[model samples]
Target chain A: MCIEHKKEDIMKLVPLGDRVVIKQLVAEETTKSGIVLPGQAKEKPQQAEVIAVGPGGVIDGKEVTMQVKPGDKIIYSKYAGTEVKLEDEEYIIVKQGDILAVIE
Target chain B: MCIEHKKEDIMKLVPLGDRVVIKQLVAEETTKSGIVLPGQAKEKPQQAEVIAVGPGGVIDGKEVTMQVKPGDKIIYSKYAGTEVKLEDEEYIIVKQGDILAVIE
Candidate 1:
């Protein structure tokens, strides 16, 4: 469920299957016109950065490898993924398919 | 966004990126006790058969490939994919990562 990265003291989670752990991008609180948006007015963030990737393995005799790796910014479906909190930090665990595109 | 398959008269839809087109498995209308369950009582089918697959291409410099091909039975997340209607046939467009497992 959770894996510790030796390089960083922060605990890293290892997602299973084609799942990827990501941190959601925060929505802007103010508009360019200098108008502050209410919490309810802000849309759900669909963009996120990949924190960890699952190990691609054989499923039903087919080999599945991960496409995106750590530090990759990605766009995902609005309703996809499971939310989790670690060390008071929020994250989402989503499958690679749920990711729509990788942002360069 | 729709592609035609030459082999079958049925028009095959090609999913983009890691997307996959699937036909949901029908749920049993009758219970094991022989009681007829109402349509609303039936749970959403999570199992589906792959109809067509997308040509996985470059994403953020990563070359992702299709893991499951046509005719493969798979189990997907309950809320994953978008429902689509084609030729009066209902189908779902889901990402390969949304697929939990391939049923053998």
Candidate 2:
């Protein structure tokens, strides 16, 4: 666990159309082969769990709305999202289309 | 190296408008601490060397062409690009807008 305390109780969880807010899950220490990844070599997974989902992305130059909601586990591209740190909590803002698949 | 024989022949190296071709660099075996990342947890960086660049993305629905051309090093979103395996070589095709920055 991080030295910083984990804070819960999110109220204002509204995402813009087609935009989604995700809280990254802490990656496991051991790999599938039971080997540990070094700090420098550890690549952050592109996948994240959806904390808040926005409406669908803009359509025809106008916001069309969204499909997924909050609490959805999604797999996104490794290169997607703009990093954001809110009160020591790291979050990512990404467009809906950027998400590739939803993990069931 | 992949088991397949490496083929090197240049006839057509064209990327569609706003699109670029890139050859992915192999991730190093060791980390900064000289530790290796497990294969299952290896996260590919969202960066690639521009092989062929298309014209700028379609402007107002028409192809606007591109700013960068072949042989440019670019950093893109990890989630970007549709992967393609061509003759034993993996290549990614992505729009110019998806590129984050050009590596100097």
Report the number of the highest-lDDT candidate: 1
Report fnat for all candidates as fractions from 0 to 1.
Answer: 0.00, 0.00
For residues A1-104, could you state the per-residue lDDT of candidate 1 as single tens digits? 66633445677688987789999876556767998774445556566799999996764455666778899876676788999987667899998767765554
lDDT of 2 at B100: 48
lDDT of each: 0.75, 0.64
Candidate with best DockQ? 1
Per-prediction DockQ, in order?
A: 0.03, 0.02
* Clashing residue pairs, backbone N/CA/C < 3 A, model 1: A97-B97
Find the 10 residues in a row with the least total lDDT in model 2 chain B: B38-47
lDDT of 2 by residue, A63-100 (tens): 45575667888888777776644334667777777888
lDDT (Cα) of model 1 = 0.75
Task: For residues B5-93, write the lDDT of model 2, one tens digit per residue.
Answer: 65577344577666778876554567679898643356565546788777655555654435556787655656778877777767898
